[model samples]
Target: MSLRVLVVDDHPLYRDGLVTAIAAMPEIEVIGDAADGAAAVRAAKDLAPDVVVMDLHMPELNGIEATRQIVAERPATAVLVLTMLDGDDSVFAAMRAGARGYLLKGADRAEIRRALEAVAHGEVVFSSGIASRVLSFFAAGSAKSALSPFPSLTEREREILDLVARGLTNAAIAQRLVLSSKTVRNHVSNVFTKLQVAGRAEAVAQARDAGLGAP
Candidate 1:
């Protein structure tokens, strides 16, 4: 069977270019494209593609949350993160969220094709530079209880923090969660205090450092 694929990105030109390039691969089928993370999730559900080519910094849900949802709903569908971010936080967040492959935007056509094919076959793929980071992270043993990312956060606080990390403002989170604006504000405050961060920017930085998700 041809590899069914979905291309997701916020930029129209970039998304179009990606779809064209991927479609040129005779073994792959471009099932659809989405402009943002929420749309990507919805499309993935509706299309049931074999792979989702994802971009991280979208407006609504962001790629990490979308990937988490997709993998949860359809474990057989692989997520390949194609983003400009090479930082540890971005890299780790996507992997932790269940991405099967990670490639920098600068990757060549051959690399992109190979990564997609490998991921669709249940193999993990990463750009050469990113592979080293993954190895270094594991070799350092960064998986201990003492190294817990959000140590003092409550479940609710973590929920709020995740939304905030995804670029949702307090008002947006309130609307999405169907909570009062004041309630969201209070949760945000508590998250800051517990995380030892003074403000939103710091909170996002801390969350991203914990690989909570940044985009």
Candidate 2:
């Protein structure tokens, strides 16, 4: 089934280019396009798309604020930010505002497609450049919080979280831990519950902030 998507960006040509590229993918459908953040929010409500391709810099509302509102109003709709801003602050802002994915504007069609698909499947995705920055930021944070007081995690949970910080797949972690893939998956679920977060990325972020692992 084609995933319904809403494209929002300030530049008409850029939006057009994105539509053209996305049209080539068989599993995606561009339900509508918006020229600004307000329009994006309205169209998102009207169209009820499965995902939104949002640009960070816009004339009204802006991507981060729009994402925050859309996510708050429609928790199922995922937002993938495709923007020129790759700075640490912008990346963090987008994530904090409920974006499920972030990627540079220069990303190739495959990368964009993968991000959309991942977010649609409730997974967080990031460009390699921004991914490195986030990882390093978390690593430094983990170091600083090494002495802070927090609830103690079981040894198994810590091991699982260390693999999460390394961005390991469930199957990869299972192989390393010498457990069944299903068992590792269950452990991951338990870890998220213990951490009180929704996804792998959030769990890893919390662990890093608490000085649980190296990047």
Candidate 3:
């Protein structure tokens, strides 16, 4: 049977091109496509495709959250992340959100097809570069843990937490990091969620205890 696939990306040209390419594959069917993450979620529910080719950054809802919701709603469905963002945070966040595979936007059609097939078969997949990073992270092991106590937090989140522990307000951190106040606030919220802290003070206390705010 042909694999049912849904292509999700905000870029019109790229999305169309991907759909065309996937449609040409012998055992894959491009069942549907969505321009953004919100539409992707709704389409996944309605179409019930075997695999979802997801893009990380999108309007309405980002791919990570969308992947999480889709996987939660339909455990049988698999999400294959296809995004330009290949940072550790993006990769680990997608994995944490239940994505079955990760591939950079630069991947060729053959690689994308292989990833979709692999994930549809209950296998985890990552591009060569991403796999190397994952392996290195595990290899570092305790050495990495000693440097950063919160393995769950992303690099940006850890940076924000360190500043918070040093008594920097959100505005200050935003200015220091050259990010918008809203973005900083969102990161802070994510940090609090990951740390399981109730509020800023609690997060600060935890960060300090972990030696994050050290000058």
Candidate 4:
């Protein structure tokens, strides 16, 4: 099935350009476009697109807040943030806001297409630069317990944990393990509970320290 996409950005040219680019892809259909976060939310509700290309900055509602609202209201709709911001804070915030993809605005058309495809499939996709930041966060180690509750995690969860420690997004992990992004996300949540940790950092730390999910 062709993926229905909603392009959300404040800049008229950028929004139009992105929509045009994606619409040209045979696998995608640009069903809607919005100039701000509020518009994006309304369009999402009305159009129910399979994916949303969101911007970080916007008037009335920011991309992060918009993503949160959209995901909360429509869990099946994947939000892919296309922004110039490459900071770790932005990356993590978008992920926490339920973004399934985070790519730089400078990304090429092929990269953009791949990200949309990945997100549409329920995977989390991050640009290489953002991926590096995620990896750096993992390298810093966890502040929580040094050991993991190994037996508490299933085999699949363990595999997912390894990928998580390396800072691969849900989409990347799913692609690596040949599992659906939804399944990977479910496993990630399970890993958090098993490790008694709340966030990605702690989960990775516990998994690494216990030698439970290391590559």
Candidate 5:
């Protein structure tokens, strides 16, 4: 069966061009299109497409939050991020928000089609440049935390901190560790307190610097 897709972007020309290009693919079907994240979310609920080709910056809502909501509401649907932004913060935020694939705007139609196909099949995908960045980030973090780090934190707290640095949400961490959400939250709080950080971002920065979140 053809993969059903929803194309979303703020730019009229780019969206139309992408829709045209994707419609030409043999195994993909363009079911709908939306001009903003809010409409994208509504369309996702209404159309239930197999994959969403999402752009990061949009009016009414942003792609990251839309991806999070869509994934939460429709676990069967996948989000493929296509954006101009390639900064570490943007890439990691999309991953944390549950995007299944990421590609820069410069990616050609063939690459985009491959990404769409990959995500539709429940596989994670990224452009070569983005993949390199992700690998380098993990490698550096691995090297830094090769030995025991975060001496002040208890073993559990340290474990939680590692997951946090890996960009997992509290619920994801809880699921991975087979702990209650409340217990995960409490451990994360302790990790923050011991690390002298006020929030997850700060804690992640510190933990990654100490090599805690290696794959």
Candidate 6:
């Protein structure tokens, strides 16, 4: 039997492209398309689709929250996140929200199809790079806390500081973490104080020396 599918993305052209591609696959059927997270949730409930190809950065509701609600409402349906944002926060948020699969926007037709099928079969899936990121996060989580720099800050502060060390502006960090610019600024200030740094340059230098952020 063909697997029922729902495609959800803010961009009309991209959603159309996905529909066209999936239509050619004999094993999958596009049951519906939604422009945003709210509409996606409504359609998913009404269609009872086997898989939801979800985009994370939506206006009304983000994909992570949508995935959590959809999975809560229907255990049989699978959420497959397709997004451009590959930041650690975005990936972990979706995973914590119960997404079964993740793929970058540039995924090929075959990989997309495979992800839908895998999630429909109740299996977890992720793009090759995303898989490695997830694994590395887990590995880092077990490190000794006492040996870490900036022990006074919370994990969120550390994450934000790491992004800062990577040379991301507060605005850029906000976009990466799906947070408002004001919140990012607050985090940045807190990070600076905790690390005893007087300015952005000093904080960044400290963070880099501690080996934070991506390589």
Alpha-carbon lDDT, every model:
0.86, 0.82, 0.87, 0.81, 0.86, 0.84
Compute each candidate's TM-score over C-alphas.
0.71, 0.66, 0.72, 0.66, 0.67, 0.69
lDDT of 6 at 53: 94
Residue-wise C-alpha lDDT for candidate 5, range 72-106, written one tens digit per residue: 88999999999998765567667777899999999
Show the colliding residue pairs in model 5. 145-211
Structure candidate 4, residue pairs in collision: 124-171
Backbone clashes in model 1, listed as residue pairs: none
Give candidate 2's TM-score.
Answer: 0.66
Lowest lDDT 10-mer window, candidate 5? 142-151
Q: Write the per-residue lDDT of candidate 3 for residues 115-169, one digit (tens) a residue.
A: 9999999999999998987887778774454234677787898999999999999
Where in model 2 is the C-alpha error above 4 Å? 142-215
Better of 3 and 6 by TM-score: 3
lDDT of 4 by residue, 1-215 (tens): 88999999999888888889999998789999998889999999999999999998787777888998899999999999999877554666677678999999999999999999999888879999778766655676731211223544566777788778877999998898898988888888877765555699767754554454545
Q: Tens digits of per-residue lDDT for model 1 on 1-215?
A: 89999999999999999999999997889999999999999999999999999998787777888898999999999999999977665676677789999999999889999999999999999999989866765687845422345534667888899999989999999999999999999999988766544689877865875666655
Candidate 3, overall lDDT?
Answer: 0.87
Question: Which one wins on lDDT?
Answer: 3
lDDT of 2 by residue, 58-96 (tens): 876678779988998889999999999765546766777
TM-score of 6: 0.69
For residues 1-215, what per-residue lDDT tens digits would candidate 6 score against the true structure?
99999999999999899999997897899999999989988999999999999998786866877898899999899999999977555666577678999999999999998898899998999999988866664588833442455555798998998888888998899999999999999989887766545799867755764567665
Q: Worst ten-residue run, lDDT, model 4?
A: 142-151
* Whole-model alpha-carbon lDDT for candidate 4: 0.81
* lDDT at 59, model 2: 75
